[model samples]
Target: MRAAVYRGVNDVRVETVPVPAIGPDEVLIRVAACGICGTDLKKIHTGSHSAPRIFGHETAGTIAAVGERVQGFSVGDRVMVFHHIPCGHCYYCRKKTFAQCEVYKKVGCTAGFEPSGGGFAEYVRVMDWIVRRGLVKIPDGVPFEQAAFVEPVNTCFKAVRNLALEPDETVLVIGQGPIGILLASLAAQTGAKVLTSDLFPERHRIAAEFGLRHPIDAGKEDVVAVAHAASEGRGADAVILAVGGNALIKTAMNAARPGGRVLLFAQTQHGDAVIDPADICMEEKSLIGSYSASEEIQDEGAALVFDGYRNGFDLTRLVSHRFSLEDAVAAIELASNPGPDSMKIFIEPNLAQV
Candidate 1:
């Protein structure tokens, strides 16, 4: 099997590796489509997250082989894999903070090294825990490309659930990347007036197509002022920082209303971010950080993804380019490049089928 192994910073190679063998309670998935995520780029660029890692978490495929003990799944069944599932009895899990769970910290599913997701390969071994609790069956009509979106959409759904959005409130979503656009769309569904902020005109234009009423270009206009005017001088009722840059945190805080909530949907890696605690305390504003998805929300998220596609979400528009597994490096390069046109890039492990 050919797998794109992460060697080091800015280095990824497609090399022939032994096909992964499934355990008695596991299953083997023949990879179909894997999405190149922002986290993968961050790991490659910053060296904050290292290599010799197979780092694709958003993936969809067909079951190539099912382990002896595996049930309700068989060869040729379409599926989407989630690499992490929390132990529901843990302290963090009990508090609904699944990402913080000890079991969740250790990746449960993989094709190779470090238990990081290995969807870049032609085959991945879905571990027993995940097979029993995390794997989702893709409906017959849904395409693999769309099913690959389940994991990412799950993460955004978790953030939306945390927001507890009010019907009459307004939401300002910073950054109009794939995840940002999804956030805007979901926030709009909650009856909130959605305002999208991004430097790229294409992204803002796409936000309009996603039902965002107000799209502001942060590069040319003042985001804080636009948000203020949209909310009748009170500023946005809530702000979601979908971009991970340190500077965006401050912008999100400033754009939110006095008693509003600010959700940090990204910024997973640690860094010094300058923020004023006084504003949070005095204004009675709350700053919350959301990371990863949970088993509790996975079913709902998957249902939403299926429903979104059936109801004309046009998620395929988010995918701007597709590359084969052999061109995995090129895919990563395109994803890393900050461009107005590039949104989501997909790597088809089974290029022959596509």
Candidate 2:
């Protein structure tokens, strides 16, 4: 089988490798479509982690075979793979902080080193623990490309859930990238007045099409002022920081009302960021950070993605480009180069059919 192997910094190659062998409690999936995530780009560019890993996590595929002990899932089931599932008895899980559980850090329901999730190949080995708890079956009529969105959508769902948004409240989602747009769309479903901020005019336009009431171009307009005006001078009830830049966190803080909450949905790493501690102290505002999704929320998130498609979430519009596994280099380059119009980029492992 051929897989895109990450060798070193700025290096990924489609090389022939031995197909993964399934354990007695595992299942094997024939890769269908895997989305190129921002984390993949960060890993490649920053070299924050070790190499020789397979980098994809947003995956959708069909089951090729199931281990002897795997039940309920047959050889022909369509599925979406989740890389991490928290141990139900962990301290973090006990507190409902599943993403921080010790077992949550274990990767590879299907691919790459340490089981972090290696969906960038032609096939993946779904480990026993994942088969037992995290794997989800894709319903009939759902396309593989759409199913591939479940993981990311689940992450956003976790953030929105943490926000505990009210129907009449206003939400200001900073950054209109794929994740930002997703947050806006989900917030809109909650009956919140969703406003989006982005440097690109194209993203702002896209947000408007997704039912966003107000789209602020941070490059050309004051995001704080726009958010204030949209909320009738009081500022939004909540601000969702969907972008990872250090500066956006401060912008999110300023865009919220006095007692509003700010949810940092991105920023996987710690970095120097400026914030006024007095703002939280005096104004009584709150800043919360949300990370990975949980097994409990995974099903909810998958249901949300499926329902979004059923109710016309316009998810496919988020995909601006598609690349084959053979064109992995080009895909990475495009994802790295942000223009006025780029959104989500999909990589089809089975591009021959597409």
Candidate 3:
């Protein structure tokens, strides 16, 4: 099988590798389509993970073979595989913090090497735990590209749910990237008026299709000022910082009304971000952070993805580019250096099918 093996930081190359051998407790999937994620890009750019591994994880495919012990799944079944699943008995799991569960911290899928997300290859092995509870069956008529969004959709939905949005509230989503669009769209689904900010006009145009009526071009005007105007001179009821930057933290805080919530949706990398204590103390603003997908809301997230598929919230519109497995290097490059024209970029191992 051909896999894009990450050799080192800034280096990934297509190489012929052995097809992963699955145990009786696992299954093999013929890769169909995998979305390039921002997290994946961060891993590649920062050398956060070791080399000689496959990295793509936003994946969907047809089951090639099911293990002898695996039940309720068979060859030819279309599925979206979750690379991580939490053990329900753990302390973190008991508290509903699935991403922090010791078991959940382990990667449950791999191509041929140490278990990392192995979706950037021709075939991948799905471990037993994920097969039982983390796999989602893609409904008939939904494209692989759409199915590939399930995990990401779960993350976005989790963030929106964490906001505890009220119907009368107004939301300001900072950024218009694919994840940002997902965040804004999901926030709007809760009946909140949604506003978006982006430097790229093209991204703003795409966001309009997602029911966003207010778009503030951060390049041209003050985002805080625009958000306040949209919120009827007070400020947004809640500001979701979907793009990562220390500078944007203050912007999010300033754009929220007194006592309003500011959700940090993208400060994934570990670092200290300087924030104004006055925003939290004097104004009584709440600054919170949400990360990863939640097992408790796994079913709800899957249903939301299906709802998006049926109600014209089609996620396929976010996919701006697709490349075959042979050209994964190019796909990674484009996803890394996103411009106004690019949103979700995918690597389709089987382009003919997707």
The digit string of per-residue lDDT tens for model 2 on 1-354 reads 878888889998888877788988999999888988888888888887687877888889999989898889999999998888888997888999987888888885646455547888888898888898888999998888889999989888888988899998999998899999998888888888888888888887877777786787788899899889888899899999988777778788898999999998878777788989987999999999988776778777888888777777747778888888888778888988968777888878778533
Clashing pairs in 1: none
Ranking by TM-score: 3, 1, 2
lDDT per residue as tens, model 1, 203-277: 888778777868898899999999999999998889999998787888899989999999998887887989899
Cα TM-score per model: 0.97, 0.96, 0.98
Error in Å for residue 118 of model 3: 0.3
lDDT of each: 0.87, 0.85, 0.91
Error of 3 at 42 (Å): 0.9
The RMSD of every model to the true structure, in order and in angstroms, is 1.5, 1.5, 1.5
Q: Which of the two, 1 or 3, has more lDDT?
A: 3
Leading candidate by TM-score: 3
Candidate 3 lDDT tens digits, 224-273: 99888888899999999999767789889999999999999888888888
Least well predicted 10-residue stretch by lDDT in candidate 1: 345-354
Q: Tally clashes: model 1.
A: 0
Model 2, runs deviating above 4 Å: none
